[model samples]
Target: MAGARGAAALERDDPRRYGVNALETLLEGLVDYAGLFPPAALPMDDAVRNYAAYRVGERRGMLARFVLPVARLDEFVRAASRIDRGGDIGPWPLSVLAGPIDASVVAAFNREHGARWVIDSIEAKATTVGEVNAVAAAYGGLIVYVEIPVDADPAELVHAIGAAHLRAKIRTGGVTPEAFPAPAAVLRFLAECVQRQVPFKATAGLHHPLRGEYPLTYAPDAERGTMYGFLNVFLAATLLHAGTEPASLVELLEERDPAAIVADAHGISWRGLHASAAQVAQARSRFAGSFGSCSFEEPVQDLAALRLLPPRL
Candidate 1:
C-alpha cells in the first residue's frame, strides 16, 4: 500500500487542447509518478530529473502527483534544487508516503518550501479500524488512502475506510508473481469499494497496457509473472461501477489480447461491452483514480504500440 496526504488536483496536461476522447478521458491524470520505487528504483537525482521532464511532456495529461516518502523529503529538496531552473519546471505536486511520520512533518516541509512544491495527499497502510481511524486523526483535512490487504477478504477494512469518508487503495502487483493478488481478490476489492462509493488508486506491476507474462525486474533473466494490465484494471472498475457482474469483471481483469479491447474517439469497448466518452470520463474522475507507476514512458510506449495513442504523444 502507498499513499500521500493533502487535497486538490495536480497540474496536468490540458485535455481540451487535444480534444477529449474516450481513451483520453479514461487515462487523464491516470498515473501517479513513482520513479523512486522498485524495479526502476532510481536514484533521487535521476528520478527528480525524469519527473521534471515528464511534467512538460505531451503525455503529461496522463500524469498525476509525484510519489515521495516523508523520510526522503530533505534528500528530495536537495536534489530538486539542482534542477530548479525556473520557467515551466516546478511548483510540483507530491503524494507523500506517511510511514511513521506525522502530518506535522509534511506541514513543516510545506511551510519552508510550499511555494516551489506541495504535498497534497498521503498514502498509508491499515488493516483494522483503529489503524484507519488513527491515520484519519493524524492527517485530517487531506486526501488519505488506506491500503488494505486483498490476500484476505478486505470487506471489513474497506467498510472502515468508507465509513471514515476516506479513499481506498490496492496493490495490484509487485516485483514477483507472489506479489500479484488473484483476479478474484482484485474483483472483490473493487466490488466492495464501488458498493461503498470509495474511490481508489492502484500501485505496482501495472506499467504495461495489457495483461501478460513479463519479467519481474530489469535484470538479464528476471523471473516472469502474469501481470495485470492498467487498462484491464481501470476499465474493469469503470464497467464494475456501471454494474457489470463479478464474473465478467474477473475475465476483464485477466484479459490479454490487445484486440479484445478497443479505444477510439467515441469511447473504449471490450468484447461487446462499451463505455461512452462521458461514462468513461465520469468513471475515471470519480471512481477509478490513477495507478502508481515507476516509469511513465512504459505505459505511454505500450499504449502507442496498441495504436490507442499516437506515436508522437
Candidate 2:
C-alpha cells in the first residue's frame, strides 16, 4: 500500500503548487515564481467577478481554477469567457465541488463542448466514493478529491480517495490557525496518500514558507481565518514523501527570504523546486502530452521565468 501511494504521488501530473488568498499573492507568486498560479474562487457577485477578471487578465499563461456553485454553471461559463476576453488566460479550467446536483451534468457539458475543467467531491460530507468514481470515469480530465474539515481520520480519507479513479486534492490545513495540520501529521497523511497511489493537491492556509511559531493573520473571506507560509506546507510534503529529510526541510524554511531560499543550490535551495518539477514532468511524459494533457513543465516554465527559482537546467 505504501509503495503504491509513493508511486501514485510521484506519478500524478501537474499537482498545483500554490494557492492564494487575495489577488496580491496570486499576482506576486505568478510574476515571481512562474509556475505558481492562483486557484481563484468564483464569486457570486458581479463586483467580485470584475476583480477576479482583472487578476486573470493580468496573469496570462497562469492556470486559474475557478470554483463555482454547481447551480451557477451558466453564469460561470459566461463569466469565464468574459474574464478571458483576450483569449490568453483561458477558457480557464472550472472546478465544481460536491453539492446537491448530479456531477455528471457538469461532466457532460465539458465533454460536449470540449471545455477544460475539474470536479472535486468533498469527502465524508457531500460526496461519496462512488460519486467520485462515477464523476472521474465520466469526466476523465482533471478530477480532484477534496478532503473537507471534520473529525474523520486522514488515513481513511486517503484510502477512500485513493480507491477512486480520480485525482485528489488533500486539504490538511486551512485559514484558521487551529485548523493547520501538524507538520509531522501532514507528512504522515501525505505518506499514506502516496502509499495509496492517490495524486492530490492542497488549498487554503498555506501562505508562508514553513511550519513553526509565527503570527497568524486572518483570511479576507473569513474573520477568524489565518494562512500559513507556502514553504512550510510544500517543504513538509516534499521532505516526508519526496525522500528529503526533516532537517533539510527545516533548512529551506529557515532562510530569511525567498531570495536566500532560491539561491542555495546544494541545500534544500532551488533544487527543492525541481522535486515538484520532475514529478510533474514525468507524470505528463508518461500519461498524456497534449495541450489539455497534464505536464509539469508548464508550471515549471512559468515559475522559472518568474524567477521563483534558479532557471531550470
Q: After superposition, how far is residue 241 of candidate 1 from its true place, in Å?
A: 1.5
- Per-residue lDDT over 1-313 for candidate 2, one digit per residue giving the tens place of the 0 to 100 score: 0011111222222334212111122222221111112222324445224434433343332333444446666665565446434433223344454432445676666665444333322212324555544544544444455453333446665566666554555454543457666545555555565567665556554433433443333235444433334544444444445555544554443333445433222224344443444332333222211111011233334345446533212
Candidate RMSDs in order: 3.8, 9.7
User: In candidate 2, how many Å is residue 201 off?
Assistant: 1.1
**Displacement of the residue 220 alpha carbon in candidate 1, Å:** 1.0
Worst 10 residues of 2 by lDDT: 1-10
TM-score of each: 0.91, 0.57
> After best superposition, candidate 2 residue 123: deviation in angstroms?
8.7
Q: After the best TM-score superposition of candidate 1, give how far the Cα of residue 81 lies from its true spot, in angstroms.
A: 1.2
Model 1 off-target regions past 4 Å? Answer: 1-19, 310-313
Model 1, 131-249: lDDT tens per residue?
99888778766778889899899988999888888889999999988999999999999999989899998999999989999998888989999999999999999888777777777
Error of 2 at 135 (Å): 6.4
lDDT of 2 at 38: 25
By TM-score, the best candidate is 1
